[model samples]
Target: RAFARSEVWDLLESCHLRCNPLGDAGVAELARGRQRRFLRHLDIAHSDVTDDGLTELSKSDRFPGLQSLEVGYGYSVRSPNAGPAFGPDGIAALLTTEQWALKRLHVSVVSDTPLAGRFEELRSRFADRLTIQQIGTDPHR
Candidate 1:
């Protein structure tokens, strides 16, 4: 609320909302206001965002400078259903859009799930700009 009304939004270039409990509604709210003009990077990992939210974000033409977006459930002991609701459909929404200026996208999904395999297929389609990885575990670790 305060953020949407603040004048400081004009100066913000990168926003990291990781670990916040903001759901689809929050994403809608954040997508509003004038900050989109300057926001370049957005990280919503572990924020409970969903496909509907991603679609809404993609449909908006407000963000012309948004270059990077990170949406995933990072390392945690969450229940099978507790991670982010991201999937291939959401990725398609983001990629097919001509509204945003997205250049790089990173998504995390659970291993062995149908979503992971779908994402793999999507990865090859947008290999230059998209990166998909398994959630709760990192190959580097």
Candidate 2:
């Protein structure tokens, strides 16, 4: 609920935004930014974002200056709606976007999901600029 307000998006001077349990609605608001030019670090871990949200974030115009993206698990408590926030396809989509300035990505891959198998590929695709880290468990399949 912390990152749901449009006022937060209006603060263009802010460089870092961190929140958990935000779900898709909060992410949608964040991704809907038309003037958030200064946002650099975005941490929305332990939320309910899916591939759609990830796709929006990967857009060339969205978060053009964003340097770090932290998603997936970071909390001890899990939501009933929680699931694989994004997978290899999401990462691949992000990599294809030419306008992103991302340097680091923090993720939590559920140990049992197919995404776990794609970590190496993600690393290879991003080379040394993008760092993806697993932070917790995988909820949905």
Candidate 3:
């Protein structure tokens, strides 16, 4: 992939692939690319990256300096269904990992899912560093 041999990999600081629909396979490729030591921000909202992709990203040692990550659609007035492909399990995997130096994260989830129950706990753990938006309709409603 281009990212793997990019000459600017060491100098690149931010990457925004919003709405690209790269999915899990694409994310895996990006994760396996050459180390991005200076990269700080990554926005993959609406890229179709699922929990498996998030897990791979979190486990990669290439992004040691990464500080901010935006994985989901938060308050975007785009397509109603165009949110993150991941859920509570993805977030848990990201936060539990010790590889990243993340200081900020943004994500969106449906209100009716099990993520709602763990939202408070996750918020408490990360405090203001984590921003989560509950989007979509509540299935019960």
Return the top candidate by TM-score.
1
Q: What's the lDDT of the predicted structure labeled candidate 1? A: 0.74
TM-score of each: 0.81, 0.68, 0.77
In model 3, what are the clashing residue pairs, if there are any? none
Candidate 1 lDDT by residue in tens digits, 1-141 = 566556776768998888887888887777775556788888887787888888887777666888888887543465654544767888888877877434688886654444656677878988988988774343654
Please tell me which model should have the higher TM-score, number 1 or number 2. Answer: 1
How far residue 65's Cα lies from its native spot in candidate 2, in Å, is: 2.5
TM-score of 1: 0.81
Q: Which RMSD values do the candidates have, in order? A: 3.1, 4.9, 4.3
Worst 10 residues of 3 by lDDT: 73-82
Off by over 4 Å in 1: 74-84, 110-114, 135-141
lDDT of each candidate versus the true structure: 0.74, 0.60, 0.74
Q: Which is better, 2 or 3, measured by lDDT?
A: 3
Clashing pairs in 2: 83-140, 110-138
